[model samples]
Target chain A: MATVAAPGTQAYARPALLDWLTTVDHKKLGILYLYFTMFFFAVGGILALLVRTQLAVADSSFVSNNAYNQIFTMHASAMLFLFIIPVWAGFGNYLVPLQIGAADMAFPRINALSFWLLPPAGILMFAGFLVEGGSANAGWTAYSPLAQQSGSGMDLWIISVIILGVSSTIGAANFMVTMFRMRAPGMTMFRMPIFCWTMLVTAVLQLLATPVLAAALTMLFIDRNFGGAFFDPNTGGNAILWQNIFWFYSHPAVYIMILPGMGIISEIIPVFSRKPLFGYKAFVFATMAIGGLGFSVWAHHMFTTGAVLLPFFSFMTFLIGVPTGVKIFNWLGTMWRGSITFTTPMLFGIGFVSMFLIGGINGMFSAVVPIDFAIHDTYFVVAHIHYVLFGGSVMAVFGGFYYWFPKIWGRKLNETLGKWHFGLMLIGFNLAFFPMHLLGLDGMPRRIATYSESGWEALNFASTVGSFLIGVSMIPFLIAVVAAFMRPKDQPDDPWEANTLEWGTTSPPPVYNFDELPEVRSERPLFDRRHPDLAGGGH
Target chain B: MAAIESSPRHEEGMSNGMLGFILFLASEVMFFGGLFAAYFIARADAQEWPPVNLLTEEQIAAGVQLEMHVGLPAIATAILITSSIVIQWAEFQIKKGNQAGLIWGLFITLAMGVIFLAMQMYDYAQLDFGAGDTIYGTTFYTLTGFHGAHVFGGAVFILIVLLRALGGQFSAQRHEAVRACSIYWHFVDVVWIALFTILYIVPE
Candidate 1:
């Protein structure tokens, strides 16, 4: 083994510290991925607080106009690239092999390579701040012309993003091959767990969409360094061309960020409701439909640029809402008239459903051409993305943490602390972001350092206070994690009476995952194993 | 100890490694796909075939033509195609358990790949225009340049596979590396052909 890391292995006679650094074990890598992404998660949150504090008052002098650009741009770059996108890779890494009854990922060494690529890329990206011009100030979108005008920091950001894209692309191939080939004998496609299914589709999206981003970044790099005019209008190149290629990848990137979150909530909803996923096949097809439609809606983000065919992109954008809506309804259907519990994971599952509904509706608001013209770059657009990403993706990430914490760590987070974390986050999240809708409608532009003494001060203040509250919500979560670590590894395999195969093993499975295998007669192999009489008959 | 009780390797299909390489190739196709889209967009926005209007008089007078000179590139493309065929033949030799054929085939393919890259370099030096001269030069160089990079990567990959083949590491039952290398080399060849057609054969 090239890596010396070992989490659940006793056979290897290496020190515990060295085991972690060089370990290629999927579970260890997964935990490393989580730790790395969450650190950036906190970093991004701090950046967000800085942004909100500056925007809290009109003519706020908290940050200079130039400093504000770096803060906000790095904020988004950290959250999307460092945190949300890779977090699913983290979850999928830990869970997919266990769920599929495979010993490890299809390519274990490549899995390590995928993970190790991240730290350097992240450092290279954030290292931009230490450079002369500060970090990439052109926003995460990094539209050219502006992208060209930034200093070496922009080049660093470009290279780092391309490296990150390479990580996910190969990581996507690993996931696809693992799920496709490694399932236990009886586990067919439909019988795979919902989380695994969602991952499969998300991997497909990452595989196809991420490379386009790499290509665009390369072009931008050329334009900056090699005097290429891929997007320079002075050289007969269309400025909109940058947006066209960027959104071609990024629009699908939206789904890449959220689909696994949807998958997590789907799992939590069904398990807590004590039922099968409502319309499981329909749900699967809906996820697939979302992946397919995700490709067509890239132009929607470009609608306001006026170079796009607004109707086609608008129609495609609204059409994507259909599959997403179907998934939402399926979650509801799983909960309808079934036994339901509001454990921390369930609370988040429910939060994901409700918040994503709002996200969907607000997203629709921007899909309409005239409405987009009004809200195009406004706080409303800001509100829409936060609702979808923070409300949608971040909510499910915590739910996943709570849901899988016992299984991964072999100990439980304090439930009350978990509840407090969830409640504060929900309130703080809504407080911080919900007001942006009103502020956006009132004509406050996003990415601006300050506003005049207009009537927007109050809402901005509320949003700022809310952003802090969201930050404060992390206190309980930190406590819960620290407290959980103080406990013994006493969790049984099926702590929550869960139905999937992951719960069939020890709380933390052994080095090679399963000691013995269970028969994969249904999607819920463990559930069926527990109740042979109800096998294949129970919902 | 197998450690695992149920046989995960019992599945009947393409090996996971092969499938993964194919998917990786899929991403490669999309990467090229994005570059191609940029090319067409650049072309669409331009006034003429080579977009010489955007070039300065000094650049034109200095003998920079956005229209590619195809003679040497044509020879390089043929060499690249021949390399692809030789690598596939190497795979067939391994499948027939003929190590000698496999070794000789890989050697020939490696030689062809080097020659092709050398010829491509010569062609680039012989060109009247550099990558920075205009959008035409930009798209031309970016597309072919990326393709050239892929060919370089493919050559390194083949060298590794060839080393393994020489090390007595492959047989009829186990030459996945050779197959993967062939698939990648073929992809690089196909991409070059597409580059040659669009940048050289197609008119404004």
Candidate 2:
């Protein structure tokens, strides 16, 4: 084993462009995903601000209705496809191998292919905005008949989504193979990190779910371009077919977005509390349950469509909360009565729990079939989604970045700036979205370009102001990252004294993760190796 | 305890390549499953079979439309199914260190694959209607087009394996490439059988 070259010795050779293109090194691929997702995030955020600006005034036009439609469409398309999904993949790519003590992902070239496919997909989606009619105006759901309406942009949207679906399928296959085949010896399934377990389930969902989306899009494309009548209500085809296909994929897709964030919380809580995760087995079961239950609840999105059967889907939708509730209790249990440190990651984790609980409760309200009919296409639904996605997923994503920054960059981020960022973001997020619930109940419908004589002006103004504050909050976060890069390195190998295998290695781990892979006796092998007494004790 | 170093035997762990192939096939199953579900849903609501009938007036008048075009597709399916067997034979030969047998078996498989593709294209061209003419034509073409693409991909795999065989890359022990190629060929064959049964054998 010692005869193998030292970690950096293999890094001596300058690699070619083709080598970089084909290289399966998880770290390089992870960085690529990170940088690419950041670009998309910025693009998607700008689109959001543009949409908010349009909504700021009542019947005071900054942009045409068509332009407003394009803005919001691009915003949803960019955020969901390019920003959220790839951001999680970026974190998973970099950290999964490190946590599991594998040298690289199982199928490295396939990994590279997956990352490379995203840029073209993003280009295709944005290209829709450049066309004559502008991007798809029909909401991200892209319901049929609206989606089937011939426009220069609709075909481009279809093509881009299909390409992105292919990329996701390939990536999902790689993750599954890696987790199953490439773990270090003694790293049994139960002993793997919570993040790894979450990723495994997420990949399974992606594998099963994404292809259905691709099929739906393909059918739409055919209906539009080839004169096929798959979704044409005038023909024998049913319009509700599109909704069924879209939500079947989209609901599991919600899990795809949140499950990894849940994993990030699971990791952060156990570390900060200085205890083994309370009810580790229960948490694992909850993750699996979330993935399993995700499929049956998709019809909840169609409650207002009135096309689907109600009681069965509503039951499934409400049942999902049980497993999700179990997760929240497990997290609080982990954080109870321990030597807790309030790191930036922990702050974000706690924020995720609090905000996501509100999001979940609001979701439960929507699950009531009659209530969903009331608020179905209103701003309440909009606010609830943002709370779940932004408050839950985006916050957890930030937590992961802060927690894993030292391992990836070998430099500690400035905690002062992070705290400031977190505080402002939390305030801005609630202020922006919380009032949306009231505005929605007050009878201001969603997807409308303007409102007239409704007394919605005050709430809309408040929401707009909050949106800008959320934008401002990003400044401190970006500045902290810049500061971390600019400062002279001052990070130790294990800055957090973490429990995972990743922290056992050097800061910014060697090209190949470990010189000799350690045999795992428990989930927290590094902690056990370093502190035997703590391993045996509850705390 | 002695610290053993640099053991070549460590490389003998269960093959990653084979495991990767199985996982890839699993994903493919989900992909095809989605398409099949679409077909099932579409068929369920289908009020009259073949919504826009494509049979020529003479054939419809004479009732020849009900007659099966079994001979051509059966030949094609036979060629594809037989190619799978021959590809496996090639893999077995390569594993046994029989270079001549491996080359001949691979050559035969490739020839049979090309014949199957040609027959498939002929069958597609001979369709009485275009894809946009009717719903039956649309579903038929889309499903079969996707199947053809898979066959084309399988052909490329076989061609690459044949080229590698020519270059003397495989031996008795290290033959994962051959095994993976054989598995892919078999998968394509299985897909063709399903397509044949659904599109041809099942009465409209």
Candidate 3:
């Protein structure tokens, strides 16, 4: 067990490794999630570096084709499954209960169970590299025919993913129940924090979508091991069936990955701008609308598959943009007429909006079926993915870390270092991904180990440099984190003058989050507490 | 501190336990829904039932036939449906403070559930096809296999409740576990009925 010295007193008995492994405290579990997901983030980042290094020069032999396939597949798998998807759970596990003023999550033991499932599942998924035929090389999508060609690693990937899906599905139900039943006295559904609303919708998506992924993986498992023919074309099975089921779950999964990041941005933007979230109810409805539309537009990914209904999926894909546009404008509107502070969190929040816009607009281009036909397997799609995930989701993740670091750890990270990290990341991000759009437009395909076209060399080289820059940008962020840990814990509770219930407690909150919460007459309970004279009548 | 205990955090409208169970059931529905979707796709894509042409020519010549017998499985379905009724009876008896009747009802239901499972295993052994046979065999076995596993889970749940009932752990107002078990038993029963109808009764 790790122990921390009590300040100006004897050493305190703190939770150690075994305590973390067995504890059901939402705070401890949340910390575990943060540590675990960030570790995977670093791992996935290294894999990304390996990929960029391989692609630094044309016809470079830094790694074999098979190795590149494994590298990129593992990269996407680690990022999507390990880092981005679960990181929200990390934040939600910590903040949702605090934000809603509950004692803990609805099912704290199940919450522990959910957290514990990840390590074993993640280890199993990655352990495939040590197996006979190299790790799963079917891309993260692991499309049929190609997916069936791999060895025991494919089996390991399928089983690990199914286990991970179960972990997420159970965790989703926990979040839903916690939000629905555990709000503080006057915290009505509409008055609930925007982050809570987003978590609720994200939970619903996880509950419905993850099991379908589990089922698809199950069928694939049987097909591989038991001679079942769910994806085999030679055995009276339809190969397109795999695409349909995979996308059905994965399209909603896209929301599961990003919506919580949007939630984090929503929280940070309102707090830093010194205002209430503009159109709170509209944001809630937009989130719900996005979750709903997310399910219908999955076939958009199937546009180039030739097995989907192009017109219907295209229209539905376009329709999702409406609610997303609502969120974008709502964010901008929040910052429109306010005392804005460009804290590191705010910069990342604003970065999410601008970058996600490009991602959304480019996604719309894919919905124009003819355009999709051209860019379907090209680096343009790769650029769009990173823009949405890295530019949007990764930025929000850092924003969330900066915003909540004080509250969670009870110390302030160096502001200057944070800004440096944010600037480097933003510049490095665009430099890395932006040129791929042009390279893809010029007909360079994705997932290949090397290309013969020397014409594409300069841009590829530039992209590699940017990728390494993004890698280097993490140093300042890591140093900032370490420096924050080294400092004494003296942050005041409401460092950002945050609006929600989480701010009503201590900097590092007590085991039970609050001694007594403020009166929640509105969504901005803390704000209302700060200015009681204007509480009931304020706009 | 006194006020904190009486706060609205503890005053939720539903029991967290029951709500959690219901939400868990919802995910189970989607899991089963995926298998059903696969079955529908395979059926829609097929020009024939059982898909015998999918087998190799030599194997076909050697009389490796495929068939689904509904008669015995129909009996098993009846038995499962009866167990669902008996479990509900057990819940009603406990609600009325008739612990003796509750015990008997659970005993009967548990017996019926075990018999249904035994009959299923026997039926699987008797079938002319396996999961490896064809798309038809694959879909059939996968759907029924998962449903059977759920039934086994529900039976274990019932056995735990039955032991608890015998130990006099539940009263009229304190039978949440018993009620949860019944809900799960009914769900498993309903799934089996759907599986029986789709896998056995439906014609090509």
Candidate 4:
């Protein structure tokens, strides 16, 4: 037999650094995603800490108003665009192909281009802080008139968002083609895993929603820089026009964040509970219903602005809770009767459920027209958003990382350190965000650099302490991840006794994914193969 | 390795290039849908558009900006629409392995595409209007300017396919590049038809 290069050596036939830079392999791209997203996570987290520290004391001049404005603006911008979205894309990049039993994405070069655009987009957004006037201070929403007055920083923000939008659009298209065209034989659409289904829906939403935002931002750029009257009221332009266009995209964008997290919980709850997913068809329908209804309720965000028809939007907004409630029950049903395993991933999944419930309830309150008028610009709104975005989406993302680490790296992360990390994060996250409810109810306005000296100080101080704890919690998690990587050993292919097709192949799967595509007989083919008797049994 | 052997390469069921073009057209529809929405809303609020009664002699001496921008574009639109027919005929001929008919049809279509681009640029240059002139002028330029950019892209695609056909690079079974270019050319033609109706034919 002719001598053959080692697997890793064969994977890298050229210079190592260039191979990584230009690599199209899904596993390597996944690692790149993990590294890039973690970097932004750290940066966005620091910004969160700074924002919390400034809020810790009442009417104290730790940072100026403008500085505080920049901090909050950059923090939201970084977390939403830089952190959460990329993290989901990263997870999809790493897992979707393996799970679906495909060799690679249909458009591998486009996938590489899509990922490369993200870092530059992040840098352009952050570069606003270094500029003369400072970062865009119109908050993450960047509403018109206020956004229009924001000088060059707003222009930079527009440019950055458009770039990020292009990246998401390309990635979404690549995902659609791959999912539709590249599935292995017998991997019919319904037989695919729920995670892949969620991804397919998320890709559709991204492709549909992103272009509208690009149009809105392009119009805004024209109004600001080129004296066009698109959103300029004084020039016969309507300010409410921006609201229509912004929410048209922003409403579906919320689903773009949560659907993947919902997919994660769907994947985890069934595995840890050692049962088939409850109401599988209902779960699929619920996800699609959420995505469809997501587009119609965008006007709900404009309840206070009164530009939208309130009763219609309010009813539609509250109607969303039905499908969302179905998913929560599905998870609960999944865990009802089984030998439940409480891995670190499971703990975070549980954290997501509890936190997302609170978020959903608070979101419902905002759907009431009068209640929104009361708390529209208050810290109550801030608390509700973070509960959903941070507590819901971020928690599930971390759980996904924990669940998939062994498959990606060929080794399991140290469980002791993982538990430590989870414990600290759970406690710290609650301490950080839970007090904001009380503070918001007590009449502390959000986005304020300073506040009156009164009852708010103590809770603000508690929130700051919690934020620091959250920051400190990352150490053990990082260490656990590093330790897992450094221990050069291969895990059993199915380390977690997982049910998906991804676990059917070797850990740290070969560059082209499976050597021979497994025949997909059911949604959980691997589980069926591992336990034939339990294959058709109900929970 | 043998277990992972490749499947017999039949004709691709749906060519990659064709799928890409179709997807591109779907996105283009959404993009223009936004502009059309804006236009309808703006028009609905106004009692009249272009305020034709308010058109002063001096403004008309603004050299009938509409005529300057759209007169030649209309001719280009006719050329593009006819070229779509020729390109479709070429695709039909390609399937029959009628090399002479295929080459003749492709050459004519490519020539029409070039003439269309040249005429659009001439229209842009002759118009005295800039972006900041008025809402009428602004919307007019933005809509037409974007359509012009799409035309330029289609022309480049047509040129690439023409060069490849000349080199005999496409077989009857493997001519996805030609099929994709035809679909794209048709889409560009469809967009121009809409643009011509809204921007030029309809009373603004």
Candidate 5:
């Protein structure tokens, strides 16, 4: 056999560093998004550790109250803005074009601009801590009046968040154009990959919801800086208006964060189970149904505020569960009685389903107005948020990482290391967040620097242990990634026998995605290519 | 890989740039929708616009009363709406392959845009309120101020299109930029009509 250059060897014309910084190629841009968001993930993770340390014991003095506030605020902000939201963009940027058989994103320069906007926005947001009165301490929601209570850092938070919103909005537009206009010859709307469908829905949500958020942020900025009274009740402005507007965007943002993760899990389950996605059409409709229903449920977040229509929002909140349930059953059906492989990616895929169920059930509980009144601002709500966001989104993020790592880098991650990473993260995630359920049930309020309740300390301590364990879990994942990179880029075109068009191309697909795409007769084009005898028959 | 070659590799749809630009406009609509929502909420919550009772005499002395003077804004609205037509005329001219008409149409649209902006600034100067005065003033200025910013953005977009038109870079079939600019101008005009009715014509 002819000798091949190593995977990381200089294969392109420009020097690697400048090539990356200036390149508008979707794959390179996607890589940049991954590296950037992952770095923020580590930063956000460390901040979370600081938060856990602060709340570990009764009246814990691990950090000062102000510092604790900033840490937790930054933790949420970094995770939500810097990590979770953009990480999906990272995946979509890399995979959507390849999966749809496009050359690059529709607006590649704007694609690069979208990624470039994040660093400065992140810097401006985090730079708040160095300024006077510390960073925004009003929580990530940055509710009005309290949001205005902070210093210039809050200003930075507002401006940076607006910038980030602009970035997401533009990115959403780019994705919509790419998916709508760039599908290959036989890839009909219904025939596209499930992940692309999810991105389509997610992009629609981002396009519509994020701008409302930018408007809300603008109002808050004016209120804070220009003596405006949008949320200041003393001057005839209503605080509930802020809640109304904030949740209007944020409620859909919940889907913006989770749907792509669901998409990733959708891709993972099918590949590992050796089955077509059960109810592929139903799954796509469920995703769109979730997107449409997402807008109506914002008031569910404000049920305790006493200003919203109670029964209407409560009913809508419960109603959203119907489509969500459809998705869960569909995922299970895909894996039912199939040739299931418990690869690391599949483990995380299964992890997402199980954990997101608990999250969904708890969320539904909050939809009950009476139940929400009790746990509105408590650790129970915190637990639910983390379960949905961390357990749901973060798990799928890892699953996507492992599933696509080979395709991206042309080398499989070490399987033993992968299992170790998955196992530790599973244990550590449950250990850390599961106790928050009890702590919340035990009357533990959220966002407090410390707790003084008699019986809450043990669970709190357990949570701290779990959080650090989760932190420790990342060590193996990083090692797996690094170790994977150390090997040669020698993966075949179809490493996992996957079913998407992305697998039809070379591992670490060339600057252009495909040389010649296989004739797409079904959603699982690669599967059809590999098993022509099984074509048009159920596997 | 060099730049992706422009070819009909995928099935036919709107050009990628036009589709992307339209999506951008969709987001812009939502952005304005948010401000309008805030405006309506503020209006619904308030007992009165320009609450003279809430104003101190000293504040009244500081030029913070609510003399809306809808006449100027109405005139500006007409001007902006007409500019949308003028820009559409430019697109029509380009579509029919009339280069000179395209140039003249774009120039008139650009001039109308500048005049509308100047008229708006004039209106802002003549107003007897500031954004910090009350929720009414805050909502008023915030809504109109953001609209004005969009107007400025539209003008800049027109300027770019005009410059391209001057450079003979557009034709009947090659005027995607001109068409995108026209669509954006129409969107701005529609938003202005909504803003004018709510801010001026409505009996709040």
Candidate 6:
């Protein structure tokens, strides 16, 4: 509180390690978020490899059913709760301030609180493994009756997730306020960077949707510990209520996971294509539309339960695709007839577009009533999700890393290594998830420990191999990251001839972010500054 | 680090902190909204809301009365409403540069908050139904219990504000913390009003 109102010049004189622990600077906190989430990403990836290995052969005894359930449940919980959801906050914390030309988030202490919340929550959730019954094995969805039956580990999972939700809810407020109030002079709502716009929308979704998850978690907790039956239909409660409330938050949570990645792609694609985002305003509005429509389509996930309005949810699910499709063409149009550069970020951005296209088209199949009934819990639904989440969001995360590496660290990740990482991850991602599509159609359900001779062995083996391939791909990314930090900070500001305000400052921007912000005559203030001849700037 | 200068700040309509606090309150609404949704869903789905037949044998034998008594909760509600006024008055005192008035107003408000919490506890002790007795008891305790927790939270907030006021921290132009406290206190009050109506006044 004292530092916020009056930051002493000497206050930064603390030892480096202590400085980070006590720091409220958005950039440092952002870096902390990245490190924390990426560690969980690795943990989740390892858990996933275990899942794939167990399923490699039919009726194989690699792991017991109990172990298998714990593995996959923790895998999804870690990936969704620890990695995908909050990783965007990492990117948002660092990039939002820089992109919008603010020195820090609107409330720096609150921002620190958000980042600090994640570590304890992540640890507490994973700590379930050490307990007698093992961590939350009722699946990440943790449907009631099943959720109620779990050991103390499930309670830990619930409490920890509620903590995480608190983190997210408050963090959402911070992002909203930062974006709303802290943009550089003349950077209107429409003039903000595409990434910031996406983050703004993501924050809104988080703010409105996350608390509902908290509520549902609270009810589940009460049902479990307090002998309440808010979700137990046998005891005057509805079982479907959990699904209703859970998906209400979780469905929008899917968007919360992906939208920022889209923002990253939007930022990367336009830059590498050497043009402004083809429809910047349209992209922003489309983001808002996706957010608006995200809430209405939660029932699509529940279609098989016979509890939802099938046609209405079906139609709303399809309607979400409209705005998404608009953004896809916007990307393509940006790349059309432009001086394109296939830098690592650009390559991953392109990968995101193509793979997300597949992801989108496949979701539409499930959006249809009959098709969903056929593939409800099958590998096909699993495949659809992996395509959207892994193929879509993870790709964007990597692209953002490579895209912003120089700006963040004042050194570029080696492109050659980056390309290897990109190619292997892409191939490995597709190889792993794509077979589930066929396996689903062939009747291989997801979340199975093993199965009898169902003739689905071949594709399952293939998917396992692909999962290992995805694991192997991480080596190059690691190497590239290590190699980059070993080098001195040598990159210049605006290294790729970028357009956003962040590029107007030094690479590895200073503590205050900017010393002399440019006169923002347009969205591309730095670009206008760079190309004085084109300073009449409409784009 | 203090070496890093803060960004230039300019916000209209509401201070950025106030706006941020308002947004925070909005999230709180959604949190309560989730509870309300569950309550309504539970109510709508039940053949009879209390579903007293579903109660355990022990609860039945223990004579867990499934009735909403309005007298005590109404008093608690009134206490909270009055505290909301007192907190606002404290905020208004700072606005008018009356530090003594602000301090007294905050002290009175905190006392009222404590009394409301005490009344809620008394209500809980007197109630025949336990939290586990039925869906009626479950939602009843869940909703009002959360509101009571919030009242405790607001009391702490007011306590802090009172201490800050005594320390001469706030005045006519600088009362962001007080203002934030005021907003939160009011939000908690408003949520209680809704909770009181839905849980106590409305017949199952």
Greater-lDDT candidate between 2 and 3: 3
Which residue pairs overlap in candidate 1's backbone?
A3-A22, A4-A22, A5-A19, A5-A23, A276-A539
Give fnat (model 4): 0.23
Candidate 3 pairs with clashing backbones = A2-A16
Candidate 3 CAPRI-style tier: medium
Deviation (Å) of A386 in candidate 6: 0.6
Residue lDDT tens for model 1, A263-353 = 8998899889998888888888999999999999888877777788888989988898898888888998999998998899999999989
Which ranges in model 1 have alpha carbons more than 4 Å from their true place? A1-11, B1-11, B61-63
**What tens-digit string does per-residue lDDT give for candidate 6 at B59-175?**
778887887678988888888999899989988988888999999999999999999888888988998988887677788889988888888888898898889889998867678
Cα lDDT of model 3 by residue, A226-288, tens digit: 989898867778888889999999999999989999999999999889988888888999999
lDDT of 6 by residue, A267-330 (tens): 8998888888898888889999999999999999899999899999999999999999999999
Judged by DockQ relative to the true structure, which candidate is superior, 1 or 5? 1
Taken over the whole model, the C-alpha lDDT of each candidate is 0.90, 0.83, 0.89, 0.81, 0.89, 0.90
Q: Listing every candidate in turn, what is its Cα RMSD in Å to the true structure after a full C-alpha superposition?
A: 3.5, 3.9, 3.5, 3.8, 3.2, 3.8
TM-score of 5: 0.96
Candidate 2 collision pairs:
none
> What's the lDDT for candidate 4?
0.81
Give the poorly placed runs of model 5, Cα more than 4 Å off: A1-12, A537-539, B1-13, B61-63
B1-204 per-residue lDDT for model 5 (tens digits): 112333453235478888888888888888888888878877787778655566767777886777688888888888888888888888898888899998898889889888988998898888887888778778888888888888889889889988988999986757889988899889988988998999899985
Q: What DockQ, between 0 and 1, does each candidate earn?
A: 0.78, 0.35, 0.78, 0.34, 0.72, 0.69
Candidate 5 second chain TM = 0.91
Q: How far in Å is the alpha carbon of A51 misplaced in model 3?
A: 0.7
In model 6, pairs of residues that clash are A233-A237
For candidate 6, give the DockQ: 0.69
Provide the lowest-lDDT 10-residue window in model 4 chain A.
A1-10
Please give, for residues A126-188, the per-residue lDDT of candidate 2 as tens digits. 888788898887888898787766377988988998898888888887888889878898788
Question: How does model 1 fare in lDDT?
Answer: 0.90
